[model samples]
Target: MALPIITGFDKGDTMKRILTSIFAFMLVLSLLTGCGKKPVIPDDDDDPIPTEFTAKVIGNTSGNLMNGGQYAEAGGWVYYSSETFDESTLTIATGLFKMKSDGSSLVKLADGAYRSINVVGDDLYALTQDGVFTMKIDGAAGRILPGISADPMGMILVLDETIVFLTQSGEIYRNSIDGKNPKELADVNAYGFYYQDGWLYYGINDASYTIRKVKMDGSSTTDVSTGGRDFVFADKRIYYRNMMDNANLYSMAMDGSDVKKISDVDVNSINTDGRKLIVSSFTGVRVLNFDGSDDTVLSDEYAVTLSIAGDFAYFVSQDFSPQHNKLSLSSGTLENILKVRRIDPQNDVVMGSGISDPYIVRMGDWIVYRDSGELTKGIYKVKTDKTSKTKLIDAYAHNLTLIGDWIYFVNDSLNNYLCRMKIDGSEKGVVIDLPVNDFVMKDGWIYYTDLNEIKIMRAKMDGTLISVIDDSDALGEIKLSQDFIYYQTIGMEAGNFGIHRIALDATRKFTYLDDSIQSFIVDTEWIYYTTKVSENELPMQIVRMNLDGSQSVVMDYFDEYVNVIGVGDGMLYFETWKNEAGSVNRMNPESGQRQLVFTSDLRNDHTVIFENNLITLKNNEDGSVNVYLSDLDGNNRLLIVE
Candidate 1:
């Protein structure tokens, strides 16, 4: 989900304009598409097939719960509260409701300025503008939970005796059901609360937007990092949106440990029947294990399908294109395709196209690629066999990585903010917003270079921005290890670059690794960099030094060109270029044994070698750059995307 921008109402007004335009467009479509044609109903004897008249009014404005359902459940009944933003002549607002599994038995349990609700036992306890109230299943006699905050955000039934709720001040509390001595548990200030087992969980609205859990007594507090997303309780665990990454699903224990990100895409909703977890991503619905194993999409896939799983999924899938076939992956069959009606995104624009840096990452099922194309930009998840193509999101995206079920990326549409969505395109939220360039991630945190000031910034997966690790604007080529992050900071003098290091586990206090260098790379034990002596001279040598800035020596005897390095398979692979031609060189780091792997033609300047082989961009005689792969045996082959 995109992070909420805490800005002025100007952007909100702009969004309202956009939404108004959409509404006008939909209104026009309904008038033109339906009103223009009226089917002549024959008399009772000649009527079409003797079926009852069926009319469905589905619109963002005037829709019963067709495709727009708020929640989902597996075995348990799903509860939803509905209020029309604009309804009829009166403009109705503020209502609380519940529904059965299959969109039946919609019971309006409360009304008039109710905030949120909690279901415990046969009663629904919800917050109204004035106070908290409880009512029976059929909206029968109601009574107030006396002596609770009137400004309650929501309610959670932790146990028979306890009710946890959030106040307008962002504070959380747990009190007896009778409201005896409500005790302040925590001050989230920006988030609400959820109760599971003996722990109380809440989202911290500070630098990380991180969800955390604590013992009911508030003795132990632990960060349950769901990449900065919100949490839903089901099947003895907390399922949450990946706060910092896209299209991700995660869950953890109630006590905050044993956190596991379960889905690869944005899990739109989760319904767990204790035995199976039915989850909905943007593309469709699937069932997963509580531990996030054995995930299977439960919906049919003829046309594009959105959310699905169990009942909640069944409700959510109604929102997708009407023409959908039930897809049975087990039998590889598509049947009962439904004819759907939809408002296409393409209809809003005439012609649009762009290209994205195709990023490939290895996760659960296959190698996922976020095709960063401009016009076709979206996060696409396909099995390694190239089957089951799920369009995660159509929003503009940048670099992406899949950690567990979520894909973290930079959304260009949202100010290049770090964002994530469910792999199925649900729960699109921001991780953090940064004015940065060339961002990267390690462990669970994001690191990037903000172009405006050259300072490096860090944030959690859930849209919480942390400036704890600030550096000078001259920073570049930053890389992080488990313990330290290394980068080169350009000095104020023209052509002066110095190696720098900062302990990751510490408070981000940086220390210069070396004061004498132009560019460098840090390995486990050594630092390799390029430097020159005189002002006019280019790189005089590629030098190696201890990480502590001592015991420096020139390694590669090269001058006047660009050098690239990679280390793998117990060897150091380096590329040195003379103009546009480059040679692939290798060295055994331990023995100092240097050897030339291979050399490419002058046209192949940008060469990369991996797995003891060379790969280069070859400019063929036809004036096109084609990539070629070659091995030590002199066997070369052209690599094509197709």
Candidate 2:
């Protein structure tokens, strides 16, 4: 049995305050009446005596509660477990809190690993790392039950005067609210459970992954004959997804009779109001009648964990923030109810090497980059002083470049387009309809390789007067310098890939620079390129030559594969890879002097340098990679995200 560990004010303090105020009022009134025959009444024009006003706490009667043990409402106040995601630890810190339905008078009850709170009459039962505990609704007199095992991932379900819950090892147990005569009802790896009448139905995680039911007296356990990932009990029927059959929704009676397929959509979760079923799928959310007919999609946004309350459906979006939203079933309207503010200190850092362009770029005081987070995989810009950050576009954007007031990028959507938007995230429009492989801006013209046509093309900033610059062979990476457009052409005929350059005006035809060129960058006077010494070896040499193919010289040689990232300030910044480990270094091409800037066990090929700041990806000890910033010489290191 549970015993009170912390005693509260024995219900006398509140009554005493009320009694004291009443006694004071009565004494003043009796004294006034006994001392004088009649007290002088104040005239209407005279000053009036002020009356005292006392504030009172009241319960809400309008707002509905979120459906779960993590959040419950009783007596007009909602108690919930609030969590904060810690990037450093990659975990959530949770605590118990309560607030009015109108989101007022918020109070924190306890701060620790507490969850699965259920309000039974005036007492609140919860599960913590220590054990199952019971407390008053006013957050006092907490005591851990004696015989209950501590299961942090367990849940508490109240049925009549008995409390049912699951242990961490998947054992089901039931006992009185005071924790007397505990009984182990079943032994199975159950992930979820629902209670109805005198029976408990739970979803098991064995080889069959089936749903089973058992009586309240812990006897006659039987399989429900339906397998699924998640099960919801409503309308006296079981609703679940058929994991063995394409993850479609199915429904049946309590006895597993008249089993029917509801829909062929891939359902993520299900919710119900006993009359209507709300289903969340890959496409969006759908509402169906009790018989799974007359289905209508409420919204096309990515929604998860559908919870229906009244005529509204609440869900969390599959976004970077996982924001909470409410949708009206009547009007098909959606509104964001709560926004999770994720202070991603490194949201501006780009950390993947698969992209061919610089994932992170700097323009003046603003840093622009592709957001690698699952929820916000688009182009974003943030101020260097950290004053503001805005998402310029809401798509998988890449190959970022800034030309004047407009920022150009490539969208990798189904219908892919060359996109441009203003620096302030305004005037967004498609520059061209074709998919761009890689692009660079020079002299008010955009040079790119068309993924669909496999040709090097040019177009004005507004997408006008488009023309192909080179179509002799398929183009790979494109670069621009002065009056020439330099690009790599695949070796289709001779099987020897080479670098080629053409004048911007088509006056000079395609001029071959070198064969077996892997990657290259061009400056005003010279072109720097990387080439494989042999057909089977990796890129090992940095060769520099004049624009007209004269004065060719080997600037540097490396045993490992090398890539040139950028060149400035009389130094060349590059990355080298010998195997799984790599390093970023800078060297003077003229002096042949090199200095190691940063070294890591993981690959650091996706890197960019701007304004004396070097940005690259760094792998953490916990198998997670984050973007980091350092000075040009590899000092002042700071993590962007983890």
lDDT per residue as tens, model 1, 1-642: 000111221110111111111123333442443421212222442212111212121101000111121222323455444333221111123355555554466566666433244455666665443456777656787887665653332333334555555554556665566665455567565354554444556765565556777666555677766454445566666776665656377776765578676767775344454465655555665667777788776663311112222322323123211222333334434443222111122212111111112244434444345444445555566653446766676655546655545666666544455666555666555555443454556555666666545777775545454664655644566655546777666667532366666665435555554345655556678777766644656546677777766587766556655454656566666666667666767777667787777766644334443445444544445433334445643255445222
Cα RMSD (angstroms) for every candidate in the order listed = 23.5, 19.1
lDDT of 1: 0.49
Off by over 4 Å in 1: 1-400, 412-414, 421-428, 440-443, 491-496, 506-519, 537-539, 590-642
Q: Which structure among the candidates has the greatest TM-score?
A: 2
TM-score of 2: 0.54
lDDT of 1 at 361: 45
| TM-score of each model, paired residue for residue | 0.38, 0.54
TM-score of 1: 0.38
The Cα local distance difference test for each model comes to 0.49, 0.62
Q: Over 4 Å off in model 2, which ranges?
A: 1-117, 124-147, 177-180, 319-321, 340-557, 577-642
